[model samples]
Target: MGTGTGRKFLFVLGSARRDGNTEQLARLAAEQLGDVEQRWLWLGDVPLADYRDVRYPVSERPEPTGNEELLLDATLEATDIVIASPTYWYSVSSSTKRYLDHWSNWERVPGFVEAMAGKHLWAVTALAEEPHQAGALLDALERAAVYLKMTWRGGLVGVGNRPGDVLSDTTALTTAKTFFTA
Candidate 1:
């Protein structure tokens, strides 16, 4: 609502399966922040193409590309929090992991950490129908958020036919609202 500052979110979707379960969850959470600016980066579309080098080094900084710069800039400008949600595979999806790998350096990007310093980060993972289906994945997300210095807000769990099937669950919708309010 406040264009004057950081009141938006940069959402990174980690499922390559189009319209897959995780994408739907991303959207549901997104829908909560009505009219809020959003940068939805689907890791599937980006495909982890090699770059000259990731400029976010702890010791030195480099100019970032439009995408990288914008992503980092928006992160610096974000007000509420940074949300990374993905479909869990053995652990977190490679797409999500790779996406995070991109954000490894906090020192390079100006104000990046200050913007994200104490903000909350919520992660949602879709898993196969099994016991503790998303355990490893949740663990990965926990460690990632910790390493990134983001406040681990909470987590969500969903299981369904495929990707979008998460929408049908009442818990999914409720969980999204809960995180949004936080």
Candidate 2:
């Protein structure tokens, strides 16, 4: 989609460390999305517990922590959503997995399925190894998008074991600029 103020982009970063490689790459990509409103959600700050289907009766209802509600609101408000994470042992980080697991609760929410349909979903991941090392994580995110009926807008994975190492990857930098510019 064209980068314009009319479009809203929500970036959900799932890295455990502050200012980690994943966050840096996600920020770089967001910067390329010119003239658009951007919202950053650090999943590390979100206190997400084990996924519990909250639509159960009051007696069986999960604890009333508002984190899920807040996240869901931000997600539904955005036209484009970026789920960024650091690859952990060939899978997504714990925070990203937990956040995605919560999607099942939305199935109980009225209109949630309809609201998710047709929205755009993008993936961003950073790993010390090659991008291929993160294949499973990418596949999981893509499948989630398909299951939710959202369009998968593709993904970017940068190699950076150390802080700011992604800055040296010209391919990732160029890809972010070109992808968002379009």
Candidate 3:
């Protein structure tokens, strides 16, 4: 089950609740990635401060600290980035949105954009509504990937509400078995 491809996947879990349907679905898809390195980062655990628009102020922003540093480093080290977030109001969760907002600051770091270019981006989401409800969330991620010059590897969506609900989604489970196969 070893990929031996040196591909590292960074799974950013953006759900408010631990072990929620979104995380479950993401874990299922990740299991298909074989022995490739995987790092799971729960957004709640590494909370980010609200992003500030300092670009126009001629102000110098301090270096990233605490969880911000951790996340930034993990992001740079990974060859693939998986945004694992539940569909909240037809878009990404607040915590997840916050993490993405920090990308603007990261972009200021020398070579950050170059480092991200050509990397793989993927999404995994679960929603109480139909899979189509995740369109906004998927579109945002896909667009961000393109902006970063990363390859969009598509997304996996599962319909579920409560914890463990996605487990009963036979269709999702079947897809999960081969979601990351390619």
Q: Which prediction has more favorable TM-score, 2 or 3?
A: 3
Model 3: lDDT of residue 166? 91
Candidate 3 lDDT tens digits, 1-182: 36688889999999999999989999988888778999999999999999885554335867789998999999999999999999999999999999999998888777889999999999999999899889989999999999999999998899998889899989888988888776
lDDT of candidate 3?
0.91
Error of 1 at 82 (Å): 4.6
Over the stretch 1-182, how does candidate 2's per-residue lDDT look in tens digits? 45445778889989989888888888888877766888999987776778766766735655335888888888889878898889999998888888888888776666778889998898888899988998998889899999999998888889999999998998998888766556
Q: Which residue pairs clash in candidate 2?
A: none
- Best candidate per TM-score, number? 3
Clashing residue pair totals per candidate (backbone < 3 A): 3, 0, 0
TM-score of each: 0.74, 0.91, 0.96
Off by over 4 Å in 1: 1-6, 50-62, 80-84
The worst-scoring run of ten residues by lDDT in candidate 3 lies at 53-62
Per-residue CA lDDT of model 1 for 37-156, tens digit only, reads: 777767666565443344635455555665666555655665544445554555767766655666755345667655566766767666556526777776776776686677776667
lDDT (C-alpha) at residue 57 in model 2: 71
